[model samples]
Target: MSDLKRLLKSSGIYFLGTALNKLLAFFMLPFYTKYLSPSDYGEYDLSLVYVNFFIGIFFIDIYVAIMKFLLDDSYKSIKNYKEKIIFAGFVVFVICLVFYVFGFYIFLTIFDVKFAILLIFLGVITYIHTIYGYICRAYNFSYVFVFSGLFSALIGAILTLIFLIYFKFGYVSLIYSSIISTIFAILIIDFNVKIFSKFRLGFGDFSFVKPMFFYSLPLVSLAFSYWFAEFYGKFCISKSISLAQNGYYAIALKFSALLLLFVQCFKMAWQEVNFSKILDKNMMSDYYTKAINEYIKFLFLGSSFLIIAIKIIFPYLIDIKYYEAFIYIPFCILIYVFIGIYEFLTNIINKINYNKYLPKICIIYLVINVFFITFFIDKIGIWAVIFGFILEYIVACLMIMFLIKKEFIIKIKFINILYFLLFLTTSYICYNLNFKFIFLNLVFLLVFVAFNYRNIFKKVNLFNR
Candidate 1:
């Protein structure tokens, strides 16, 4: 298959899986808004930050090396890496367990014992599921991966509903369902890939995977910085504004994450294609440029559609209590648009063996995010964090452009940026004007398409050819 065709097939499989997994958020939003109060939602969101923090810090992003080594042509046998991957998994589990036990006692002073226990339990299971997922992808078992994800999501959704409707378990139901479903996913993945069965304490040489661990160590900092940049806003909102306001911000972010359904799938496919072609210097720069240009076009247009659709359907999708969240949805969605761009750039950086710059960039992002929220949150409420994230991404993209100038350059067209801003601005205006001005938003979408007709259709013609 051609490169583009391969990318599309891989992206399509991942897209189907992620769409179903994330559909849980949209499908359950109504039940969540109805059954859980704003305070409950706020607490649940906070709880998740804690769980994610555990994974972010201790998981150490070893999956990065797993993919790199597995896909590297220099590697003699993929099977040789399996035992080392399992060893790395064991190492991650033990470290997390140690921290969880130590932290659980400390947390009891601040949170309920049961809540703390459940959160740790969920975190450990999530880590296992995530590692297994990486292993499946590394083996190129795309069908297996998709099936596991789909089944996991379906089971989770069903269980969550049963708990919410029949038992009225509130936010706890969400946590419980996730824990159980992820466990099922882990089992399904292991059954198909049999990664765990390769584990033997003495069978794999720790020295073999030692370099991978060393490579992943600095990425732990990047992961932590990213985690803080994201969840710190919620923390600031809870303390400076109100838990209820934080709840509103959570709803907006969940809605914004809908765009990830596309971004992540593309990233998965693009990463596969990009890494596999790293040794081929001839087509690298030109392909990267074209891929990003087309990606930005897709990102901007998809984001515009999501922004308008959310505005139109906001009242029906969420409860009346969360109507205040609509104002933040557009801003949040725009943040992810830049995030998609950032991810693409980071992939390029990784492709060219320039990953050492990622942690520095993430640190810069952390500083900007913290400074913005700490100073302006009380004045502008959630808008402070939203604006901070937007500015952080813009600055990060500029930094990447400078860094990549020496060797690889992905030239992004200015017109794409202009239309992105214009589409978003028009949508915000129409949304604020309510349903009466919806036609104006439609006009902007059409105008964007009309302006980009050649760029869009040219790709279509190429794909057909």
Candidate 2:
């Protein structure tokens, strides 16, 4: 089978899974707003900053190493690293537990009593949930993978509903809901997939530790930098404006996250297929060019479609108080578009023996992000953060260009860049017109396809064979 065919097959399954999962979470927004005040959500969002930050640090991103070590036939000769992976997860949990014990006050300031407990629960569960997902994908348990995601989301949404509506628990409802739902998810996956059966607690020569550490440790800094770059906007917002305004920003951010659902589904399947035969460098290089070109084309067109759809429909779904959130959606979507591009560029970076450039790239992103938030946010409001994110992504792409200059150039159709520019101009116009472009958006969509008719046909032709 062709690489495109395999990607299609895997993506189709994952698309269904992610769509159902994210759709459920999206619908929960109405239920949440009906019960909780903006202040409640602001505090909840604040607590999550610490939760996600600390978890990113100590969670260690070790699960990715499972794919790194095991997917290739080359690693089949070496003893499987399953036990070592489990041991590493235990080490991560212990580290997080210690951090909380000594520095509990750091959390006590931002987190309420219940929120503090929620953070610690999240710290431990990160490793478990991540490792489980990676294992299922590695073993080609596609149904199990999809089921596990849907189950977690469904259980969490249902629990949150009961707490907020029937129990009337307020913001703490989220805390209660997440902790209970994740527990059920862990139990269900363990029961069905038997992930724990493969794990035994022994050092076993400690071979996997050294290589995996070198591979993953650099990623921790990148992860931390990513969090700082992202959270800096919220921090600036809370300081310069008000918590309620930050809450609105968070809602916009959350809505933007739906786009990632598609990106992640594609990524999950892409990683499995991409790595398995990636040692054949020539074919991999050709595949990289073709895949990235299509990815870019899809990104612009899909984002344009979302812009129109959201303008016409999303306003009615959200409360009138949040109707201003419509303006933020376009910028929010741009952030993830750049992130999706970065993920694609990693195809080149992943092959290099040293990852020194990766951290350097992240540092550049962090500096730009901070400077923009500090200087521009107070003057221009939330637009600064949005522009900052776009600039950072541009810098990131430029850095990728420099790295690949000495090695290889991943050529993409330049017309796609033109399409992206056109979409950006149209989106800005639509936003300024207060989304009165119902007829215009339709005409633009039709014109867009007419302009790219050959490319669209070419995309379909890839799968015909």
- Give the per-residue lDDT of model 1 (tens digit) for 12-117: 8898888877876587789899998887898899888867765676667777667766677775655566566667656655665687657645765475634777
Clashing pairs in 1: none
In order, how many clashes per candidate? 0, 0
lDDT of 2 by residue, 1-465 (tens): 677777877887898988998888878887766666665676678667766666555555666666666565665555545555655544544555676544644655654445575666665675577777787788788887788778888888988888888898887778787777777767777777676766654344466666766666666655677677766777677768877777777778777777777778878877877667544555545667787888877777777777776666666566666666777887888888888887767645655544557777788877988888788887899898888888888788778767765565577677787768866876776677755565677687877667766654556443455
TM-scores for every candidate against the unseen true structure: 0.91, 0.89
Off by over 4 Å in 2: 80-114, 201-205, 279-285, 429-440, 443-465
Q: Which residue pairs overlap in candidate 2's backbone?
A: none
- Range of the 10 consecutive residues with the lowest summed lDDT in candidate 1: 456-465
Off by over 4 Å in 1: 77-79, 100-114, 200-202, 279-283, 434-440, 443-465
- Compute the lDDT for candidate 1: 0.78
